[model samples]
Target: MVVGDASLEIDTVVIGAGPGGYVAAIRAAQLGQSVLIVDKSEWGGVCLNRGCIPSKALISAAHQYETVQNASSMGITMENVKVDYSKVQEFKRGVVSKLTGGVAGLLKGNKVQMFKGEAMFINETEVRVFNDQEAPRYKFKNCIIATGSRPIELKPFPYGGRILSSTEALELPEIPKSLIVIGGGYIGAELSQMFAKFGTKVTIIEGADMVLPGFDKDLTQLVSKNMKKHGFEIFTKAQAQSATQTDKDVTVKFTVDGKEQEVTGDYLLVTVGRRPNTDGELGLDMIGVKMTDRGLIEVDHQGRTSIPHIYAIGDIVPGLALAHKASYEAKVAAEAIAGLPSVVDYKCIPAVCFTDPECSSVGYSEAEAKEKGYNVKVGKFAYVGNGRALSLNAPEGFVKIVADAETGLVLGGQIVGIEASNLISEVALAIENALTLEDIALTIHAHPTLGELVMEAAEVALGHPIHAIVR
Candidate 1:
C-alpha cells in the first residue's frame, strides 16, 4: 500500500470493485490501459459478497429442501427430511468465497492494481484513496465510477436489532419462526419465499396492488400462488406505518384496504427498493459530476458522465439496479475510454426473478410494445403440453411471445416456469438481433424439451401450433 501524499499516475481508475468496477478494470487492462481498481468493501461488492450470491445460495438450499419433501407426488418417498441451516449457511459462504476469490484472480491475471479503501474524488482526473492505516492519491487520465446501491430503508423501520435489511436477512444464524417483509418486489418475494421454504411463516406488506408490480400480473400470479402454498400471508396496497422491536421479536404496524393492522415476527425485513451509492464523502458534487435529484449520475450512450473523461455505470446511473446490467455497461465504458466506438445497447437486457416459478422478461412486454405504437401479436404456450415439463412434474407455468402483427418481428417474450432465467436468454438474443417469429419457428427444436416451448409459441404466432389448439 502506498502511504504519504505521493500521487501515483494511472491510465484508468475504477471505483467500487463490484461486478461493474472489476469488469471495467479488466477490460481496460485488456485494452492496454494501466488500470487501478479500489473499493472500501469486499472485492466482488454486494452482488457476490452479500446480495446475489448469498441469497441465491440460500434459495437453492431452500429449493432442495422443498423438492425433497414434496417428491411424494412423483411416487418417491423419503423420511427424515430436514434442512440444517448451519450447513446451508456454510454452503452459501463457500459459494460466495469461491466467486469473490475468482474475481480477485481475474483482476490479478489482468494485471490491474487492486486497493482496499474508500475512494474520494479530488478533481476530474484525480482521487484520494484512504483507509484507517494510510491515505494514497492517484492521478488518472480516465475514471469509471461503478458504485452500486443499497437496500432502501424505510424511516419507520430503521435497520437494527430485530429490524433487518436484505443483508441481515441473509445472515440469520438460524431461520426465524416468523418474518414480516415490507416489500413484495423481487428482493422481498425471493427472501420471503426462501425463508418460508425453511419453515418460517412470512407476512408481506406491499404498497403496490400486487407483488412484483413491474412484471405482468399473469406472470406474477403463479409466484403468488406458490407463496400461498408455502403459507405466506400477503397484504397488497398496504403501507408500513411503523415498527417496534423487543429483544425477542419485532412488531410491525401497517394499513391495508383502509384498515390498520399489525403483525409480529421474529424479524422485520424492509426491501422496498435500493438507493444509489452516489452520495457521501465520494465527492461527486465537488468534482462537478451532474446527478439527478435521486442521486443518479447522468451519462451518455457510452456511459460517459458530465465530464468527458469521467464515467458512471450500474446502480449509480439511471437504469435498473441489476448486476448483469452493470457488467454490460462496464465493458462499454472501458472500450469507450480505450478509444473504441463501443456503445451500450439496452434493447436486450433481461431481468429475472428467482422465485419458485422463476419469472423472466426481456425487451418489451405486450403492453409496452403496444404503447410503443407497434401492432402486436402474442403467442402463448402452457407448460402442461410439454413432455419434459410433465416428466419433471413441474407443469405450472407458460411461455408468451409478443411479435409485430404487421412484420412478424419478435418484440418481446415472458416466461414463468422452470429455468425461466435460462430460457429468457434465447428470447433476449432474438430481440437483440431483430429476429422474427418465423426465425424461431424455423429452427428445429428437439421434442419433449423446454426449448420447444419457445418454438411452439412462435408457431402459435404463425397460426399453426402443433402441440396446442389455437383459439
Candidate 2:
C-alpha cells in the first residue's frame, strides 16, 4: 500500500457509513461543514445490506407463500404453491443494491467525500484510512464514530459450515430441511417464524422462560401462539451446551431443567445478540475516548465523547441497537458540531418486531410506569373490536395505552397486531410531543382502519370507548 505523507483536511470525518455514519455525514454537509465518510464494508452498513433489508425481503416472500396456502379461510383456494429460494435471494439482493446505490447517490448529491477503507485513529483529530492499494491520513475538526455492532460468537458454537450467525443465516443458498435456533430474541424469533412459514421445521431453544424476553408476556404469548400454529417447536429455559457438525447436518446438545437433550438439524443458527465494534485496530483507547466495560462508548446528550471534538452514536454507544436511534443521534451530533443547540431525547424511542402479528412499544409499559411510582391506568382495545382487523383475517392482538391516572398524560403504549410497526409511530409521535390521551382520542382517525385502534384505546383510557364495551 502506498502511504500518503500529507493528511487531507476535512471539517468533519464520519467513520462507518452505515445508517448512522452516512446520515451524520449528510447532515454535517447540510450544516455547511466539509464532510468525508468512510466504510470498510458496504455503503449502507449491516442494517441495509445484511440485517434489516434482506431479512425482511425473505420474510415477505415467506409471508406471501403462507398467505396463499392459508387462503382457504378467505374463500380463495390455491394449489401447488412453492417457494423458489434462489429467486427470493435475488429479490432481496436487488432491494439491497437499489438502497445502497441510493445512499451513494445521496452522498454525492450532498457533496460528501466517500472513502472505502478501514479507518483507525492516528492522533487526537486525525485518522488513517487504509485500503488494498493506498493509505491516506485525514485531519478533521470533528469526527463521528458509527462503526456499529456484530453478532456475538459463542465459544461452544463457533461459526462455520453448519453453525451460522445471523449474517450467514440470511445468506443461505438453499432452504434447510430443519433449523435449530439458539436464541429466542426478536432476531431469532423473526427468522424462526419466517423459515417456518417457508416450510422449514424450526426448533427454538431459549434460556429465558419465554421468547422475546423484553416484551410483556401478553404480546409475546400471541406471537408464540402463532409460531406454534406454524409448527415451531419451542424449548424455553434451555441451555445449549455444545454443537457438533457433520458434512450434511449439525447436532446441538442442550439441557432443559438440568436434563440433557439434543436436537439435530440441517443448520444451526445462533442469534444470541450483537456486541459493539469498539475493539480491534480502531485504536479508540489510544485516543483517550472513554468506553464502558461492555465495549460501549460514553456520549453526552449531543453525542460528544469524553474528548470534546470526538463523538459516537448508534450501536457503539449506550442505547438500543436500532437504526433509527442511530440516525436520530447522528442528526443531533451533526447539529451540535455546527454550534446548533441540539440534543437527544430518549423518552420516545419506539421499538418494533416484525413478527407474524407484529409487536411494537414506545415510552414505558404499565408495569414500568407503576414501578416508576406513577399512579398508572391502562386502556386496552382488542383487535377483535376493529372491523378492518376482521376483514384482514388478523385479529389476535390488542392496542394498549398506559397513562397517568391524575393527568391523563400518555406515558407509553404497546401494540400487537397486524401493521403494528406502522401504527406504533402515531403513539410515538404523541409521546414525543407530550400529547395526552385526549389528544389521541380526539384526533379523528379514518373509519374501519387499523389506526382507529389507537384512538379506541385512548378512548378506553378516558372511560368511554366508542367501538368496544367499557366492561
Candidate 3:
C-alpha cells in the first residue's frame, strides 16, 4: 500500500453520520453541493442505534406492560401478565435496524458519498478518514464535525454487566428485581420510572435536592411526586461513593446530608450526564479548533468553528444535547456552506422528558422569566379539571402558562401531564411567533381532547378560564 496524490474533490464533507452529520450531508447535496459523510461507527450514529430510538422502544414496551397490569382497574380484567425481556430486546433491535437502514437509504438517494471509517482533521480544509486495516489518508474539502457525545461515567462506579450507562440500560439482558439509578436528571428519572413500571424496585440517588435540577422547581416537584406515586424511592442530595458488584446483586454506598447509607440492587445505572465526544485521534488541536473547558467544540451562530471553513454542531457544541437541536443546527451549517445566510433561533427549542406523564417546557420558565427581569403573570390549569384527562384516567398533572403582565404576551409554557410532549408544540409556536395569551385563549380547541388544557391555561392567564372555576 502506498500513498498517492489522488485528490478527492467535494464541496462539503461531514464527519460522524449522526442525526446532525447525515442531515448536513443530505441538505448540502440537496443544495447542489457534492457531499461526503464519514462515520467511525454505524450510519445512524448514537442517537438512532443507541440513544433515542432504542431507549424509547424500551420505554414504550414498559409503558404497555404497566398499562396491562393496571387494566383490571379500568374494567378490563387480565391474568398472568408477563414481560419477555428477550422479546423486548428483539423489538428494540428491529426498530434500530429499520431506522439505520432508512438513514442509509436516504444518504444513497441524495447521492451523498458515505465512508465507514474514523475521521481526523489533516488540515484546515482537509480531513483524513481511515478505514480498518488501511492507511490513514482520505482527503476532503470543507468539513463539518458532528461527532456527538457519550454518557459521562462516574469515577467511583465504572460500567460493567451489572453497572450500566444509558446505553447498557437500554440493552438490559434481563429485568432486575431491584435497580438503583444514580442521578436524578431526565435520563435517570425516565429510566427509573420505566423500570419501576416494569415491577423493578427502583431507587434514584441525586446529589441535588431535586430530580431535574435546571427545571422549574414546581414543575420538577410534580414529576418527583408522580415518580413517588409509581413506587420509586428518591434519595435527593444523596452522593454515591462507590459500588460493589457481585454475581446476584450490587451494593451502592452513598451519603445523604452527611449521613451514610447503602442501597442494594440487582443492577446500578449511572445517568449523571453526558460529555462531548471531542477526543480521540481527531487532530482537532492541530486544526486550531477552539474548545470549551469541558472539551466541547466552540461554534458561532451559523455553526462556524474557529477555523472559518470548518464547522461543528450537536452535543459537540454548547447548548441542549438534543437530537432535534443538532438536526436544526446541521441545517444552518449546511446552508452556510452553500453560501446562504442561516442562523439558529434557540428561543423556540422544546425540551421534553418522556417519563410517565411526560414533562415538556418551551421558551422560558416562570423563574427564568423573573430572573430575566420580566414582570410575569402565571396561569395554571390542572388535568383534574379537563374532561379529556378525566376520561383517560390520567388526571394528575397540570399546564402552566407564564405571560408578560404588561403586554399580555405569552412568555413561556410548561405542561406536566399525559401527552404533554405533543401539546407543548402549540406553546412553542406561540412563543416563537410572539403571540399574545389572548391569541391562544381565543383559538378554538376541539372538545374531548387533552390540548384544551392549553386553551384553558391561556384563558386562566386572561382571568377567564371556561373549563375550571375562575379564581
Kindly state the number of residue pairs that clash in model 3.
0
List, residue by residue over 246-335, the lDDT tens digit for candidate 2. Answer: 999999999998999999999999999999999999999999999899999999999999999999999999979999999999999999
**How close to the true structure is residue 139 of candidate 1, measured as C-alpha lDDT?**
95
Local accuracy of candidate 3 as per-residue lDDT tens digits, 247-285: 888999999989999989999999988998898898898
After superposition, candidate 2 runs with Cα above 4 Å error? 1-4
Better by lDDT, candidate 3 or 2: 2
> What lDDT would each prediction earn against the true structure?
0.94, 0.94, 0.88
TM-score of every candidate relative to the true structure? 0.99, 0.99, 0.97
lDDT of 1 by residue, 333-394 (tens): 99999899999988889999999999999999999999999999999999999999999889
Per-candidate clashes come to 0, 0, 0
| Deviation in Å, model 2, residue 415 alpha carbon | 0.5
Q: Measure candidate 2: CA RMSD.
A: 1.1
Reference-based TM-score, model 2: 0.99
